[model samples]
Target: MELPVVHYSKSEYIETDTGNKVSRKSVICGSQNIVLGGKTILQTGSVIRGDLKRSGASNFVVVSAGRYCFLSQSCIIRPPCKAHKGAFNYFPVKIGDYVFIGESSIVQAAQIGSCVSIGKNCVIGKFTIIKDCVRIEDNTVIPPNSIIPPFSVYRGSPGKMVDELPESIREIYEARCKDRYTKFVPSVDA
Candidate 1:
């Protein structure tokens, strides 16, 4: 049996030669400051706020995602902010390779390590650091400045560790992320 269509046609998303596909409908401010590694997918209606940079004279990246990463539809990926010594500034969001951010999630995270999977509608508060091989369940709310250790699953409103991921799942996660990138194609007909 053939697989049903999910993602919009490849045409709707601007596919770079390196396989980075960004939806036309997505709102990306300060495109120059955003760094996307090859084969990254930014789905429709996602908002990447690269415009919110740190307060300084030097040029700093606001949002940087590694290769084979996926940001789902309507998600908001913005830099985290905080007040330091009476001055407030936005910190960069660093996402490692093979990361998957679910739909409608608002991420104001400091770092998301490789093989991390975040479910839909979650709100990741500022300065949240998600370590490698972590899974966050849908609708979860992570408190600010929280650090998720590796190989764990966090769920619930005040996101708590529910379980640990098996070491075997690392390869599986990598394969799934890579597969999704390869299978995303534009629909022949609307």
Candidate 2:
């Protein structure tokens, strides 16, 4: 199908139960079932797609922004599926409030919690639970079904818990979320 062209620039608030946001310079194909909350920024060169409707289930991608969330440049979020047919017949990706997904990352069948920071070029695997206040560094890969505890720093390939972040850093993270809420503006077109 030839999808309609959609573009957003200059920071507008958009809220929709199901739609795709294609940047003027980017493409988002087959993400018709995705839900983007108000003030969520879908930056340049990002592509988010899912086959939820094709597979006969509720495979929509949900991005809930309590205040604000940013899906940075060149990121891909798709449903988790295996090479074989019907492998990923059932799995969806869910991201929560105040999440910052950095550039060039692929997240599949993952549940990311509030206040999470996923660094650039990271690959979050299927069925993983990334809890709140977690900082995943750049170029890391999180294996499938791993439960990352809250308030931790995970790094390296196949990502391990490096350590508990300092309390001060936690405070800073909390403060950042607060700042986002304070500065958030619901999209005018919402």
- What local lDDT score does residue 4 receive in model 2, on the 0 to 100 scale? 32
* Model 2, C-alpha of 157: deviation from truth (Å): 0.8
Model 1, residue pairs in steric clash: 9-186, 9-187, 10-186
List candidate 1 stretches off by more than 4 Å. 1-7
The TM-score values for the models, in the order shown, are 0.94, 0.72
Candidate 1 weakest lDDT stretch, 10 residues: 1-10
lDDT of each: 0.91, 0.67
Model 2 lDDT per residue over 73-125, tens place: 89877766544463535455677767778899988746888778889999998
Q: Identify the leading candidate in terms of lDDT.
A: 1
Off by over 4 Å in 2: 1-22, 52-54, 58-67, 82-90, 166-171, 177-190
**What is the C-alpha local distance difference test score of candidate 1?**
0.91
